[model samples]
Target: MDMIVWAGAVLSLAGVAGLVWCILYVMRLRRKALDDATMRSRMQKAVLVNFAALAVSTLGLMMVVIGIFLS
Candidate 1:
């Protein structure tokens, strides 16, 4: 139980870090003066990655909550 809680906490933290990175990456992309096509493609990729990271973070948070309740 304690191990599960620890793992969940670690995963949650990692997910948060990933999300932060995604935000910064998108911000940097927006600031760049890329051509239309390249900018569009990069934006699409960034959106996908950001959504994935958000999902991971959400799941990690849920797991942590569950672990806490269980233990």
Candidate 2:
């Protein structure tokens, strides 16, 4: 159970890091003043990453809860 909790914590941290990366990437894109088509293309990729990060975070939280309950 403790191992599960720890693993979940690690996963949560990774997810958070991914989210931060996405934010910084978008900010950099915005500063570059790219054309609409380029910006849209780039933003679409970011959106995919953002959703994946959110899913990972959610899974980690669920793991943490289940670990605590089982313990």
Candidate 3:
């Protein structure tokens, strides 16, 4: 229950939220009637966000593990 663990937990939660957002966004995107160009553009943007969220979640889990070991 160190502060680092708490921080990590928060970071992980935020990443999860972002991931959920990406899911919802993709769902909405699928429902849209935009052309291929616009869809691809939006999908690329979503990919970036998805990767960022994954990275953050991984970093958070790493931080939690490191904190536990250090504690």
Query: How high is the CA lDDT of each candidate model?
Result: 0.81, 0.92, 0.94
Number of the predicted model whose TM-score against the real structure is largest: 2
Q: How many backbone clashes does candidate 2 have?
A: 0
**In order, what is each prediction's RMSD in angstroms?**
1.3, 0.6, 1.0
Q: After superposition, how far is residue 51 of candidate 1 from its true place, in Å?
A: 1.2
Ten-residue stretch with the least lDDT total in model 1: 1-10
Better of 2 and 3 by lDDT: 3
In candidate 2, position 25 carries an lDDT of 95
Off by over 4 Å in 3: none
Off by over 4 Å in 1: none
User: Candidate 3 at 42: error in angstroms?
Assistant: 0.5
> Tens digits of per-residue lDDT for model 3 on 1-71?
59989899889998999899999999999998999999999999999999999999988998899889999
Give the 10-residue window scoring lowest on summed lDDT in candidate 3. 1-10
